[model samples]
Target: MELEVTLLGTGVGIPHSGRAQAGLVVRAEEPLLFDCGAGALLRLAEAGLSPLEIDVVLLTHLHLDHVSDLLALAKARWLMGANEISVFGPDGTEAWFEALRSLYPYLEELDVSITIVRPGDEFSLSGLMIRAGEAVHSLPALGYRIESEAMAAVYSGDTEPAASMRKLARGADLLIHECSFPEPFVVTNHSTPLWLGGTFRGAGVKRIVLTHLYPQTVGREEEMVRDVRAGLADETKVEVGRDLQRIGV
Candidate 1:
C-alpha cells in the first residue's frame, strides 16, 4: 500500500501569501480529508484533485478556520455526480451540518451523510481504521489517528500540547501537529513550539510536520525548529508545512 499526504492549508484563521488555512488530504487505503478550512477547495484544485475523489471528510472541530469549506465541498461533489459523502467530526457536527444545509434549501434533497464522532470512537472504512481522540481545545474537539495496512498518520487539530495527542500519535509514521504560535505567546487553546517541544520528548514519533502556523510565527520559524530539535532525543525530522506541499508515508 502507498500513502500520500498533502498539506492544502497550513495557516491559521488569518490568510497570508503562499498560505491558506487548516486543511490536509491523506491518500492511502482511503482518501481521507483532515480539515476543510478556508481556501481548501482552491488548494485541492491546485493539487489536481476533485472534490468527487474525496471519500471522507474528517473534521477536527467546529471552528470556522477548520470547517469553513465544508459546504463548498458538498456542493462541488453534488455537482460532480457523486453519491452521498461521509463527514465525520466531534459532537455537534450533525447540528452544524444541518444548520449549514438549511441555508441551502436546494441541497436538502441531495444525498449527503454526516456522522458525528466522539472521543475514543473507532471505525473502519475502505480498509483503513480510524480512531478519534480528545483534543485540548476550547470546544469538544478531536484528533485522529488513521492506520492502513502499511502505515499510519496522526493529525493534531488546534491543540495545546496535550497528553492525549501524544498518546494518539505514539509510534506513528508521521505526526502532523499544530504550531500556531512561536514561543512565549501566553495563549490558550493553541500550541507554541516551546510547549510542543517539551511534550514531544521521548514520544518515538518518526517525523513531525508543524502546521496551522499563525502570522506571529512568520519570523520565528528557525527558532521554533531549533527548539523542537533540541528537545527531542530521537533524530526526528521537523519541517514547517506549507500550502500544497505533498508528503509520503
Candidate 2:
C-alpha cells in the first residue's frame, strides 16, 4: 500500500503567513488525521481531501489550539453524508465532545460516533495498528505510534521531553515532534530546541520533523535546526515542517 503523510498546519497557537495551526494527515489503508486546529479543515481542503475521506481523527490533548476544529470537522462530515468518524484522545475527550454537542443542538441529533481513548491502549482500523502512549503536557495528553506493513510514523502531540515518547518512537520511520520554542525560554508545558533536541538525540529516531512552532521560533529556525543536528548527529534528517508539505515513507 502507498503510504503518505501531509503537514497541514505547522504553526502553534498564532498562525503565520505560510503556516496554520497544528494538523497532520497520514494516509495509508485509511486516512488518519492528527490534531484539528483552527485552519485544519481548510488546509485539508487545500490538499484536495474532503472531510468524508477521513476515517479517524486522533487528538493529542484538550488544548484549544489542538482541538478547536473538532466540532467543525464532525459537523462537516455529517452534513456531507459520511458515516460517523471515530475520535481517539485523552481522558477528557468524551466530556469535551458532549459539551460541544450541547452548544450545537443540530449536532446532538446527528449520527456521528465518538470513541474516547486512553494511554497504553492499542487498536486497529483500516488495516493499520495504532498505539497510544503518554505525553507530558499540561493536561492528559497522548502520543501515537502508527504502524502498517510498509511504513510507520510517530506523532508527539505537544509535550515536554518525556522518556515515554522516546520509547514510543523508537525505530519509527518518521517522528513528528513539537518544537514550540527556540531555547532557554523558561516555559512550562512546552518543548524547546534545547530540551527536544537532547531527547531526540537519545531517542535515536530516524528522520525528525519539527512542527508546532511558536512565533518565538521565527528568525531562529536555522539555529534550532543546527542545535538538533549537533545533538542528533548529521545523519538524522531534521526539517522544519511547512504547511501543505507532503512526505512519503
Candidate 3:
C-alpha cells in the first residue's frame, strides 16, 4: 500500500502568515488525519483535499493547538454526507470531546466515535500497524509510530527529550518531530534544537522533519536544522518542515 504524509498545518498556537496550527493528513490504506488544530481545514482545502475524504483521526494529545478543529472536521463531513468519523486519542479524549459537544450542541447530532488510547497501546487499522509512545510534555501526551509493509514513520507531538520517543523512532524511515524554538531559549514541555537533537541521538531515524514551529524559529531555520544534524549520525536527512509539504513514507 502507498503511504505519504501531507503537512496540512505546521505553525504553533501563535499565528504566522505562511503557517497554520498543527495538523497532518497521512494517506495510508486510507486518509488518516494526525491532528486537527485551528486552521487545519483551510490548509487541507489548499492542499486540494476535503474533510469528506477523512474518516479516521488520530490525535496525539488534547492541546488546543492540536485539536481545536476537532469538531469542525466532524461538522464538515456531516454536511458533506460522508461516513461517520472514528477518533482515537490519548486518555481523557472522550471527555474532551464530550465537553466540546456541550458547547456546540449542533455537533451532538453528528456521529463521531471516540476511542481513548494510552501510551504503549498497539492497534491496527485496515493494513497499517500503529503504536503509541508516551511524550514528555507538560501534560500527558502521546507520540505515534505507524508502520505499513516495510516502511515506518513516527510523529512525535510537542515534547522535550524523552527516551520513549527515541525508542519509537529507532530505525524508522521518517521522524516528524516538533522544534518549537531555534536555540538559547530554554523551554520545557516544548522542544528546542538542543532538546530535539538529544532525543534523536542514536534513534537511527532516516529522515527528520521539524514541525510545530513557533515564530521564534522564523529567521533561524537553517541554524535549527544544523544543530539537530549535529546530534544525528551522518546520512540522516534533516529539514525544517513547512506548511502543506508532502512527504513520502
Q: Rate the local accuracy (lDDT) of all candidates.
A: 0.87, 0.85, 0.88
Give the per-residue lDDT digits (tens) of candidate 2, residues 69-123.
8888988988888748788888878888888889877676666556777878999
List ranges where model 1 is wrong by over 4 Å.
none
Candidate 1 C-alpha RMSD relative to the actual structure: 1.2
TM of each candidate vs. truth: 0.96, 0.95, 0.96
Predictions: Cα RMSD each = 1.2, 1.4, 1.2
Clashing residue pairs in candidate 2 (N, C-alpha, C atoms within 3 angstroms)? none
The predicted structure with the larger TM-score, 1 or 2, is 1
- List candidate 2 stretches off by more than 4 Å: none
Off by over 4 Å in 3: none
Q: Which ten residues in a row have the lowest lDDT in candidate 2?
A: 106-115
- Supply the TM-score for candidate 2: 0.95
User: How many backbone overlaps does candidate 1 show?
Assistant: 0
lDDT (Cα, tens digit) per residue for candidate 3, span 100-119? 78897766677778888888
